[model samples]
Target: MALAAFGQLNMEEPPPILGSRSVDCFEKLEQIGEGTYGQVYMAKDKKTGEIVALKKIRMDNEREGFPITAIREIKILKKLHHQNVIHLKEIVTSPGRDTDDQGKPDNNQYKGGIYMVFDYMDHDLTGLSARPNLRFPVPQIKCYMKQLLTGLHYCHANQVLHRDIKGSNLLIDNEGNLKLGDFGLARGFSHDHDVNLTNRVITLWYRPPELLLGATKYGPAIDMWSVGCIFAELLNGGKPILPGKTDPEQLTKIYELCGSPDENNWPGVSKMPWYNQLKSPRPLKRRVREICRLFDRHALDLLDKMLALDPSKRISAKDALDAEYFWTDPLPCDPKSLPKYESSHEFQTKKRRQEMRQNEEAAKKQKLQHPQQQQHGVGQTHAASHWPAGPNHPMHNAPPPQLSHAGGPSGHHYYQNPHGGTPGPNRYHPNGNQSGGYNNQSRGGYSSSGSYPSRGRGAPYGVGPPNYSQGGGQYGRGQNPIAGGARNQQYGWQ
Candidate 1:
């Protein structure tokens, strides 16, 4: 069945050349892997003749034409050039191509697509862990753990959060230096910012208590939890410590090993949105011994601190790297001197292609099952005719347009209250008016007072006008649109 699927994949086009104006610098060798939104290929540079990996993304799969996560990764990678993180070389995009009835490229065909170029990595941590004859000694394990922490520290130091930290995302070079890969789940943090409001990030297995409980406001501590799990996995030959089939089961496993959390351990535990419903107040039970018996007592101690039930008490990545276990005699092996594995690339390629075929088949089944729905899934159509380009269009390089309203600055206008205090029933505008352009007005506009009506009274003070509507404010007449010195305040706006 897999062979038949592969045979149907229209391989006639000689695996689209990497440098056909759609991409430069690299020459396509073979398909290596397929991600949720893109295809990855092994390629070599045309100019430097250096081997590299090229990732091609289908614009149609992204609502904004480019995935925001992908954009975020690129932005973070561009600024973070470190030895531990994967290096991003360049980005290329090509216009859509016109093809003849026979599917051959027509002379007038406009070729356009998006491609990302990255440094070539021989294998990932998952492959290494699965090798039958390979046994990771304690010293070698320590080296990998230290390297992982070093890379993690680099990310955290730069105020970046790697929400997804797992073996598959850890890339290995020929020298065995494990560099952190996959910034798709990373987010930048601003100093003084307390919590992140996005709870739906990170894989379930590696997710921390804060995330599993639906706490949007979290911190780097979330990533630290995953690091701890990765550390345990490295020590135990790549086995997850708290592997669970469901969210509740996963939390149960975590509670069993670390014991239940409390205010004493996690000061802000009770304040979390899901705090009341969790089993937090229950008596502590479960022993760490049942998890991994081979872990040395000192290593177990470090793991205990790292996998603390209370995020506030969990050891930071920096602290974990400094643990005495790492410095003990028979110290960690140098990454450069590690032994190399035989060709696993072909196996990886075949496995990835099979997964891609399965995914495509599943997508086709979904389409057939939901024929009544819109023919194009949320982001399926890629034809240029359906994608209109404008200044505000996500694909365009122009800034969003400015909007104006009566009684406010012509540059950008919004409705406000006349009482010079909170907005009244008649002073609200349902649609938002901004300097760039008008958003759904019914959604409500920012107040000159610099508070969002939709946000609770105790909500953190924001910089610009309120983004959404909440309490006290109503939809109606636009007044007091400009607040005194509201624009000059630079609090949450930045």
Candidate 2:
């Protein structure tokens, strides 16, 4: 009965017009992931046989016309052109079902839907990092970081801010290229910091302290703080450096890692609207160098600047590119030099982790039931039977299945280094210093992007997006421009 009901419901639904010029150009393969605003599917272009990702725009509850977030994303993508940035190929739409008196389509009726087309990527950074036993070497980490900073630099130069920067937002192809995606939370900003903006943006874990303290007017420094979180995650073996469950908890984590902010270190912190409401009860000593002692001296130095308590003191993406970490030994390798891996997505990995946990729980229950089952031998066999392939399993010993990233089986080899050896610590360091960065607690830190324009003593703030409903914000609206000296150091990159 349930099956018949389901079939009837499906039959009553209107069939999607699949062969028209709009949505008919491509065939959806499968659902790859979901985002804040809509679902994403793997698709293939019929004309060119090229694989792509189709991001469907959600308009189910919108009484208004097209979504403002989608409009802003489209506008910003059309203006941005960079290798590390995700490219927006074109948008396709389906026709609505409404008709008028003469049987003609209703002019006022909204379109059936829209899909944002993009190049298909095999994995996101989070998924790739979650693969069992997979560890990223120092050079590979540098390669990814450099690409991330480069893309962010481009966005800042163009006066755009990617408020949400997280592991899943960073897409990675089999060839090792990393492209920044998910620009829904992004907005444009003017150089004058007089306008009020929302601080309720950016993922909690990667959000900066300024935003937590309720700063309405901000700049590119917020994005740079996210970059710092990502950098620390990579260095800490793919685990998020600050995984806070709530806004209050997230702020606490920041205060714990970094020292409590004060007027001395952060000139205007005490004046922030939420400073008193969210400020730490007691001052916390700066423990960055203490906790991250294993990290490279140069990398820690850059991280310190990136995660500075004061937004004005934070490093810009352009200046980050020139940091000593990139210039040190075990230099960043070419993206193409990285190894090829199976297709992985955060959605898939989370499911797998859940399954593993369930299996373990089942095994524990079985052991509890058969407590006397030879005191060990039979229980071991039972648990092994329920386990997924382990290191000793035949499935685990077999060669990893290759993916057709470029075209065919041969294309899987394209990600392999053309040189004699793989680009990793083993190829460069004989002692295997890949995991030795925090071997001791003795290290010193000091340091500090297409960045904002150089500001003098009386200049304005970084450019921000214009005020629109949901997408745009007004600039220089009956407000004073921020002091120039504080922000001048941020845009020092000439």
Candidate 3:
């Protein structure tokens, strides 16, 4: 009884590690990423020779020693322990050039490079999805989804909100085990009646309706919406569900797919400032299943509940784990049994991102050089949207004519239409006598413009049917004449 009393009286906080144990402890490798708050590096621990990711918390001009956000994240991550959650091993400070010969850290003259060491991950979800060759089978996708939900369940149970949930924040090792990462936007909640949260936490595409409508008080439902969006993205060729240009357009896109919100559907939606202001009462259209025909009924049902317009009605993570989608055919594979992908995801992502940066730089230079001439036309960049409907389309049910192309460009390689003549004064024969994308003077399709795409696939870039020609048979001045013209040229494949 006396020892217990003495221990209770003498309890104290652990000593603060004001400096690193040694300057040469970690071998600094190449920088992996740079963000608004800090930079991450791939480093090696000299003592253990273990590879790790070191995130440098930037404390450039703050009179305060360490960043408050960093401190908060560290505190929260230390309490979390799960197979699907990133592990924070330790925190250490790197001594700057101002240190003495003995490598003692000097706070006054030293640049504080406080680092948070984390478990090494081979790739992020975004990088893995971006790989041209790697494909996520149905079982693999289910496995990933299960892991994500499991991690999110743990966080919500601990009263922590992972406000920023996106593909890039999920890390995966070589063994196909996925782990939740990027705690910079995470926040802890106290067990009290009042809890205030910022609405501008998630990425624009993954944001839910409540948050988009300026909701400041929210719960785990906010994350469930992101899970739905991520699931949809995984099924739909790794593209965002709602890619809108502006906030209003984004809301409109949501309404178009999920049906517009009424007070009965989404309680308190009419009170939102953005409700009646976006499109002045457009009709609600529901076509989510039609758009995502790849998913089965059970998967669709789970996604519907997860993406409910009413936040109160959204399914919780624990509930989602019990959905019938998981117990269906093509059962979720074990993480260790999943296919092993190359660790080249990081390099490929960096290369693609660098190329995109270069393209943006080039576009900026072009705009600066000729703002008057080429004023950012979306039609030129995205030609697929403007292509004619397919042969089976209701409005375009006419059987197409047999078409062929040669391997050379000439001054007069005109089409041999049913009119049985070279393109001339009478190019328009309205009665089903049309040839594919015409006005050809070619060794290839376009000499001064567009490249001649190779054959093998059926209709390279949705090459229009033979009946796409309008009343005026002569190709117009601004016409896109090539059958399989340029589309998403920046990305390597179709």
- lDDT (CA) per prediction: 0.55, 0.65, 0.58
Using Cα atoms with residue i matched to residue i, what is each candidate's TM-score against the true structure? 0.63, 0.69, 0.66
Report the Cα lDDT for candidate 1. Answer: 0.55
Encode model 3's per-residue lDDT on 1-494: one tens digit a residue.
12312101111223246445553587766555555455566667788777777776666646866666676677777766666788777887766642322345434444646777787776677666655533466667778997798778778777777876777677887666778887777877543527767776665666787777777778888889989988886765465576554566667778888888887677788887656666337668666766665566777888888878888899988777667776565566666565445443333354444455555556566546655555446666654443323221222112222221210010010000011111111111233212211111221121221122222211111111221112221111234222222211211111
Q: Candidate 1: where are CA atoms >4 Å away? A: 1-25, 97-111, 280-282, 343-494
lDDT of 2 by residue, 1-494 (tens): 12223101212232233324576577776666653455677677788877777777767657787788777777777666666788777788767642222345423335677778787777778767756556577767888998798778878877788887877778887666888887887887766888889997776667898988889999999999999998987887665666665667778999999989998888989999889999999999988888888788999999999999999999999788767787665566666567767676665554554455556666666667756763656547765554334322122112222222211111001111011111111111122233424332322211111021113211011213211121111111233224334322333323
- Model 2: how large is the Cα RMSD against the reference? 16.7
Q: Using lDDT as the measure, what is the rank order of every candidate, best first? A: 2, 3, 1
Worst 10 residues of 2 by lDDT: 408-417
Please give the range of 10 consecutive residues that has the lowest summed lDDT in model 1.
411-420
Maximum-lDDT candidate: 2
Record all residue pairs in model 3 with backbone atoms less than 3 Å apart, i.e. clashing. Answer: 408-443, 409-442, 409-443, 409-444, 410-442, 410-443
Model 1 Cα shift for residue 424 (angstroms): 58
lDDT of 1 by residue, 178-291 (tens): 677777767777546675558766555567888777687667788888887777766654445665545566677778777776777677777777766776456676466555
- The runs of at least 3 residues in candidate 2 whose Cα sits more than 4 Å from the true structure, single-residue gaps closed, are 1-20, 96-111, 354-494
Best-to-worst ranking by TM-score = 2, 3, 1
